[model samples]
Target: MKTTITPRVRTLVLLFLAVVGMLFAGAGTASAHAALTGSDPSSGVVVNKAPTQVSLTFSEKVATNNDSLRVLDPKGKRVDVGKPSNISGTTYATQIRSGLPDGTYTVAWQVVSADSHPVGGAFTFSIGSPSKTTVSAAAEQDVGGGLVGGLYGFGRYMSYAGFIVMVGGAAFVLACWQRGAGVRALQRLVVSGWVSLTAATLWLLLLRGSYTTSGKFGDIFDLNLLGQVLQTKTGASLVSRLLLLAAAALFIAVLFGAYDKREDEEKRDLTFGLAIGGGVVAAGLAASWALSEHASTGLQPGIAMPVDVVHLLAVAAWLGGLTALLVSLYRAPADNPVGRATVQRFSRLAFGSVVALVATGIYQSWRQLGSWSAFTDTGYGQLLLVKIGLVALLVGIASISRRWTGRLADSDTDTAKAETVVEETAAAEEHEPEKEHVTASAKTGGSSAASGDPKRAAQLARQQVAVDTTRQKRLRDADPNLFGLRRSVLAEAAVAVVVLAVTTALTTTEPGRTEEDAKAAKASSSSSSSSSSGALTLDMSFDTGGKDGKGIIRVDIDPARVGGNEMHVYVQRPNGRAFDVPEVKVAFTLAAKKIGPLPVTPDRITTGHWAANGIQIPMAGDWKISVTVRTSDIDQTTVDKNAQIG
Candidate 1:
């Protein structure tokens, strides 16, 4: 029982821990907060007129503190929609002042959610015109796919899978890495899991530069922005704290491992200490996920850091343990029967690991998604289904490997028995060397023995050759079964890759709606009463106010439309030359809408003129004009932008 760590084992341990670290650090980068699932106004809604306010609802409850939503008009300008608010008191909302005229507008949002992950998006909607600004409700922007997107996706997959692996792996390895493993392995596992956790902290700090810049491979040293990001919650500051905690756990484990290493096998009292430490670390990491999403808020304390930390550590223990076992199996010096014994022991551990993984996965999903209907109703549910399917595949592969393991182990017994029999027979044949070697006297058995009993000698030589061959050969029958084990392990690895791919995809897709809009329009369709359209022919875009020559204008809009009424706008100069008024385009925005050419575009886009270009200024006062911005079949938004002839 040498205390010195062997270089090979040390290398194996280091590599295994590094993988765990990558898994953890990457877990928060690309995932969570239930995705957009579905929005109240949806991404792009054209209305007959403006609504009272704009709302965005996700599959889960989200934050609405500080910043959340942004509304932009066609000219790429930010329209002060309103202070962000939560629609269901769950997601975000922004009250747009009522009189905005039709055109195209964009709604951009970012938030941290209960899962403690950042999510953001931009969508378009046109007034009067058919605007389907939604890119793909089910399509998630993933990490490694594009800058921040990929990080989020990667982090998500890691968070979920890492929990199962790290937790289960820790338990498995703990029970088997040593005799008194619940305690002994727990301490080491903590240390092992922490190194990467620390590395992730540093890497995340470095990663914020990617956020400040447009893409990956950008300047890693943007000092001022870097410092700012570290200071900000969405950036390095938060991740750093997680890393520091993970580091602390690691240092504690190292001390624990050192102390335990000195204790006798008879006095292995590591379990109590290890369990207490593990419980604390688990609490810390799980809390981290609650604050990880972009949809989170101080108002809803549940969705912030705590849940995230828990999800992360649980996943790490489960997946991290699996990863460790895989490595241990791969590098094990199990050259003979004894080594195979260790393999058998791990196979049993793996069986238990799989069971624990399933239970935990179910628990976590339920806690996050809420209902079975959400599985298909929300975009997040759909992607989750895909990941689940992949997990099923992984299970199938594991089953195959298990079957092969049994066969291979059984073959070893048969092969050993046959070899023993051959050795016994060979020993008996050796007892009669003189008889077996007959031919001639020992003195004459040299060069010219052929002159004596050549035929007899030839028979003896053949027997000896056959006996030697049998002893040397490990029944060719055993080889195929042995190789089968290799195939099974390879298949598991392949399935594991598929799980990663599927999970990555899940990180991007929307969780979808908890309950889809049930409203059906008799002539037109919309889901909600407040969200429904009126019989109003209200042109979606009509301008009311703007200085004769000034580019900047303070325009207001009513967010809700009245029943059966048309909204109008008038844009004119103080001199009153409304003739040939071409090249006029009105761009509108609301939380529920997008930016595009108003459907009422009579004026060509080439000329930058609207449909009402140069008609006439009937009077010097405000004139009513119509602009069309069609969002849905019935939930259309008609906005009014105002301008007056001075």
Candidate 2:
């Protein structure tokens, strides 16, 4: 028989599908927390002599090896010597070959962040003088994108979805409604959860290697790559999850098979055992995430990891349980409807889950945010706000469901009293004497039926139909309240789906506290480097009104004060590679003091560099500095800026 779905159910189904679509739509946009704070022989600078080693500093500790850092020459060839070394927890250095050529070079790095996410980037530095480079920054830093990243992110969401559903559904059956163990619909739901989790876990295991490096789809199935993945922390977590799922399979069997057939006391004993075992398995599954994700590496990891586990379990119990309850309400057989007691029991469990959620959520927010400003300042904090809002909406819908449950309970109690009264009156009437006319009719009918009387059979059928009609009417009277409760629960489940999706994204985002910390570290390092160097550097861009005339000019001055100073200039093409320019001129003027535009003649020292020695600044004041460059004989442009000679 074909069954029609209610309008509410149809809407909820559509909303859930939309949420799932959104999950995959933006899943590959995960962020990393280990930011590059500083690097030696920094980007776009010219050094007269190439340094023996290139060093990098990060805001947080990261895991790196020889392959993590690569130094490539202007021609895109590896130039680094021996293995790269981790100079410190937050610093890494690599030795480069001696007597390197005078040209630009690229340094590309990829490392596992403190939060266990892979991040990579590239930069360029010049030796002696900048030169045209064939290396492209975009091509060198393709560490986290393409098909592999998308698939890995999809696997992550699926794993979370499966674990929540399986754990929550089993908890509902074992704790709130044991009779649900025998329901085929609940059985299928929990089994689907197991299947999803197992499949996603395997998919993740296969993709982890490629997802962390190169982000190539072809490398996903490479056994060597897979073995490399097995040695990492995330790999260990995935393995643990699979082992726990094995135990989960046994738990599901006991719940539906042996427990369903047990007597009352035996059922109770089995339920107690299942609850304990399930709790262990669920916590273990949650730990697999807690020990590998953001919680394990950030501030106060000892407390954060355990709290994260609580948060995951609480979420599963509340959101997952809602799915199981929703299925039971709409799909249970007419003869075995979800009872008022079952609804009340789940209501209590949901309340406790919400309490745990709030407590753990508060601690996590404090840990990740570290301050109030992050709520408005950072992406992680903003997403956290969205989740909190959705959770509140879910709770509101849940309260409405509770009210409907209370109403259903009251209506059922009244129905029970009415049924009892009807039964007692029927019992009293059983003892009453029958009329002589009725007694004669019955005796005649009995005789006709024994002789094969169709008329008597028809009369008996009509009497039985009258009894069935009264019972159906009684059931119809109670359905309005049941339907109301179902609608509210459906709303709760719909909102919970959005909450879960936001949560998945939140876990992948860089926390606000870490972002702020990185920014502070970068600023401090920049300030220290500037003070120690005691040199003024300025960059300007010029378009010389010719084909390919636009380029950047970097001007450097030592002790740029009211005295003689050496000035050097470097020019780079629009592509950021250094190139030679024809006919360059520089002049300075103290316009406020009406000083002459004193010219400092520059002579070519290298292919893309020029030097002017002992240029004098007559006074300590704002001076207009003008630079002119001619790409061709007729094509030239002059750029001007003010400099403070202190």
Give the per-residue lDDT of model 2 (tens digit) for 223-266: 98788778888889999999999999999998899899998788
CA-only RMSD, every prediction = 17.1, 14.8
TM-score for each candidate, following the candidate numbering: 0.50, 0.72
**Model 1: per-residue lDDT, tens digit, 1-646?**
1111245356544654454445444544444443453343444566666665667655456544434676666665566455787554344677766676677767766665444345666666666665333333322233223555445334444444443444444454444454223243344444444554554455556655453233354645667657756555556335745664655556355444554465555325664565566566555555444444422432223442344454445445434555544544333322222124444666676666556556656654654354576676666677678778877876777677667666654536644754665566556556867534542233353333476877655666665554444443333223455445544664565455455555545434333321121110111112212222321122121222221121111112222232122223333221122212333333423222232222333433232222333222223322233243332234322334322221
Q: Rate the local accuracy (lDDT) of all candidates.
A: 0.46, 0.79
Give the Å shift of residue 257 in candidate 2.
0.9
Best by TM-score: 2
Candidate 1: 10-residue stretch with minimal lDDT: 517-526
lDDT of 1 at 630: 30
Highest lDDT among the candidates is held by which one? 2
Off by over 4 Å in 2: 1-3, 6-14, 27-29, 410-478, 521-646
The CA lDDT at 641 in model 2 is: 54
